[model samples]
Target: MPKLRLKESLAGLKKIKININFKKKEKQMPIPPPPPKPIPRGLKIIEKYPLYEPFSHVVIVQNPKTGEHQYILDELQLDPLERGVYDRILEILLAEIESPKEEILDPRKFFAESAKKIVDKYRISLGWLPDVSWYKILYHAERDLVGFGKIDPLMRDPNIEDISCDGVNKPVYVWHRNYESIETNLQFPADEILDNTVVKL
Candidate 1:
């Protein structure tokens, strides 16, 4: 009877050892979690201004996640005073350039002064106007014609095909999808003509 009891106890101990060994093997052969993914770099922002063109500006803000560069217009935050000053300068430029009354009574001074004031106050720098010139004024005038002209609300319309001026004696030509080409009897003198053509090209 004693020998049988001893044999039974030994059998139970052997079973316990086998179960512990199984658990140890399972722990040693653990399935590791997948390696973590790498983090991506952030987006890049770019702003560019076209030379010899007023208000022909571009602001590109890129998104790394979307892989797209968003072209932002009318995103510049300007104060009411700044907006008013800009509009007034534009009005003066338009009136002067369209009629071009006299060489001595040039509106370039007004444009330069107003633009300079805005730049100084707002600390805004134009890409083309690094060195202000009469040519820059002409460019701005044309831009205003395209952007704020009765035909187009200045930068508000993106469907304008072409804005062309042959000479002061000749008319300004605008190409439209519906009308094909329309001519307006707008004239400018030799100086204005040469200045506009040269700056635009």
Candidate 2:
């Protein structure tokens, strides 16, 4: 009798209805990058090798027309976002980086350690950056700070005894231990760039 009463009372209640809806937000996809341009006929790469593993490489090229050989230093290139991060990190390091404690301590090693800390601290502000970009910025920051700015790879190379730049828009020349003297593909495109190179050196 109680069970029948319960069923009769439940049947007295009205049926419930639910409205369900799902909406997805639209996302704008990134544009595809342009294809690489072809290498010009004037220059041809003879040999290529890594100078700093993933960060830097060296390319030897010769002009077929002039039979002139040149050395090119290929380093990791950062995009706009990565470049911005690199610039900011460098600015902070330049102001706050510590000097060597002892004369015997390697300045490069000390600076690199400090710079790594700064990079780690600054990375918090940079959200969703890829490792490639992060490493590119780090490499550039270290390159500009403790290491030689543009020609750090060349400096590391034991074969080259001397490096020289004549003037703006002129190729830098390196006195290779084996090849003697040869021009480098690195050239100062403008007067200010040449001045900056001098200051960096």
Candidate 3:
């Protein structure tokens, strides 16, 4: 009778193990994958004007033709707080132009011409353009007063928030505080610097 009871107990243990294995296999479920991340609108600008070691203030411009963006540096190189002030001015200008009338102010033209005037006025104040032919003074003053290698006349304009040059003869890129970068629908050739100097002369 004792040996018969032992055999029954062993059989019960084997049956319980088999049931647990079957439930584990039957209850399994498939795992789903995670969702993908979204891309940022500003990434194109960021790529051109990459943030390097020293986090400088940057202005980004978009190309109208290709719908691409570029980045440039501001001449004043303001701190974060000052950049806020510049941004406010841009916001005001943009808001003013939202509903255009017959004579909407062309901000780009205004900024460019105004900046040139400031440079000319400065030259007069310094007596740098004295008696020299007006045309000669206008042409050379830019080179004489501002350093020739990298300086830009547009930098004088308060409205121009950023400027960049890949090479000479290349379309110099500008960031108007109110309007992002103006593409100019132009590009400088690979040897733009050499081409630009010859043309300027």
Q: What's the true lDDT of residue 98 in model 3?
A: 33
Give the lowest summed-lDDT range of ten residues in model 2. 1-10
Q: What lDDT tens digits, residue by residue, belong to model 3 across residues 1-201?
A: 011000011111110000011111112113221122223454444332211112212445554556776544432233354344334433333333232223424423343344355545444434332232332222222222221213333433344555555553556656655666664323444353333332332
TM-score of each: 0.25, 0.70, 0.26
C-alpha local distance difference test of each model: 0.34, 0.59, 0.34
List, residue by residue over 1-201, the lDDT tens digit for candidate 1.
011000011111110000011111111112222222222246455443321123333333456676554332322222355445455555544444332233434233444444445445433433223333323343344333422222122123233256555443544454433434544323335444334333322
Which stretches of model 2 miss by more than 4 angstroms?
A: 1-39, 189-201
Instruction: Give the better candidate number (1 or 2) by TM-score.
Output: 2
Name the better of 2 and 3 by TM-score.
2
Under the 3 Å rule for N, CA and C atoms, how many clashes does model 2 have?
A: 0
